[model samples]
Target chain A: DQQVKQNSPSLSVQEGRISILNCDYTNSMFDYFLWYKKYPAEGPTFLISISSIKDKNEDGRFTVFLNKSAKHLSLHIVPSQPGDSAVYFCAASTPGYALNFGKGTSLLVTP
Target chain B: DTAVSQTPKYLVTQMGNDKSIKCEQNLGHDTMYWYKQDSKKFLKIMFSYNNKELIINETVPNRFSPKSPDKAHLNLHINSLELGDSAVYFCASSQDPSGRVGDTQYFGPGTRLTVL
Candidate 1:
């Protein structure tokens, strides 16, 4: 069973627009939520993360919002650029456990 | 500097063959892990080691073994590989699992293994 799920398989956004990706989890024990970006031929790299205590976390043009009650989280990229076009994975980590990754959402930012 | 590097980026072998994939990290971290990405693009952790000691082993088969000769090195060995063994394997490292900022794991380019 997949503890984490990304309902959207792909997303398309125009350049200089805002892009929002959604993720949901069934496990409430997961306290750490993280986002990773991956290119065509490269492994995923860390993007942004949020703790269960906080509702939102931001890094530059990227922001992550979490709703503990709903067991959902989202990654937002404001003013999306062409380079931001890639697969985005939402992962969760429980204490002393490995990260559980979603199926990933491919984002296409057209110029 | 390449934080994490894996050898034999691409491997193609027969179903009954045995093969090993090597990984090295220069990030000077104490924790390392191996993950397998299947055809469905699901990345799952197989093993984890900290300072040359095995810490976690998921529900993988006994044919698969992980070795950590040192803190910076982790290797995976598959014996009598099966067709289902074909997948992309990634090696990653982190500072510690103390939930610190540096605990963010860095992944390698990945090694694609095709077992026919």
Candidate 2:
């Protein structure tokens, strides 16, 4: 079973626009949520993360909002650039270091 | 320097062959993990080691074994590989394994294995 799910397979946004990616989870034991960005031939790099205690976390142009009640989380990228276009994966971890990942959402930022 | 690195970026072998993939991390992290990404791009955790101690072992076959010589190195060995074993394997590292709540995992470039 897929504990974490990214309903959208792909997303597109214009340059300098806002890009929002959503994720949902069925496991309530997962307290840590993270977002990773991946290129075509490279490994995924850490983007941002949020804990269950906080509702939102921001890093420069990237912001992650977590809704514990809805078991949902979203990543918002403001002023999205072409370089930001890549596959984004949402991951969750229970009480350990092992992570469960979603299917990933490919983002295309057009200029 | 690469925080997490895996050798032999690509591997191709016959169905009954045995192969080993090496992984190393220079970040001084105490936790290392192996993940498999199938053709459909679904990532699944295979095994995890913390400080050279086995911590998590997913529902993987006995043909697959993970060895960690130290906290900085974790290797995966597959015996008598099958066609279904063809996939991209990623090695990752983290600072701790006790669910620090905000620890980030660094992943390697991944090794693609093809079994005929």
Q: What is the interface RMSD of each candidate, in Å?
A: 1.8, 2.0
Each prediction's TM-score versus the true structure? 0.98, 0.97
Residue-by-residue lDDT tens digits, candidate 2, B3-97: 89998899999999999999999998989999999988888899999999999998999999999988999999999999999999999988866
Question: What is every candidate's C-alpha DockQ against the true complex, given to 2 decimals?
Answer: 0.64, 0.69
> Candidate 2: which docking quality band?
medium
* Interface RMSD, Å, model 1: 1.8
Off-target runs (Cα >4 Å) in candidate 1 are none
DockQ of 2: 0.69
| lDDT tens readout by residue for model 1, A11-98 | 9999999999999999999999999999976888999999999999999999999999999999999989999999999999898888
TM-score computed on alpha carbons, candidate 1:
0.98
Model 2 chain A lDDT-worst window of ten: A91-100
Local distance difference test, candidate 1: 0.92
The lDDT, on a scale of 0 to 1, for candidate 2 is: 0.92
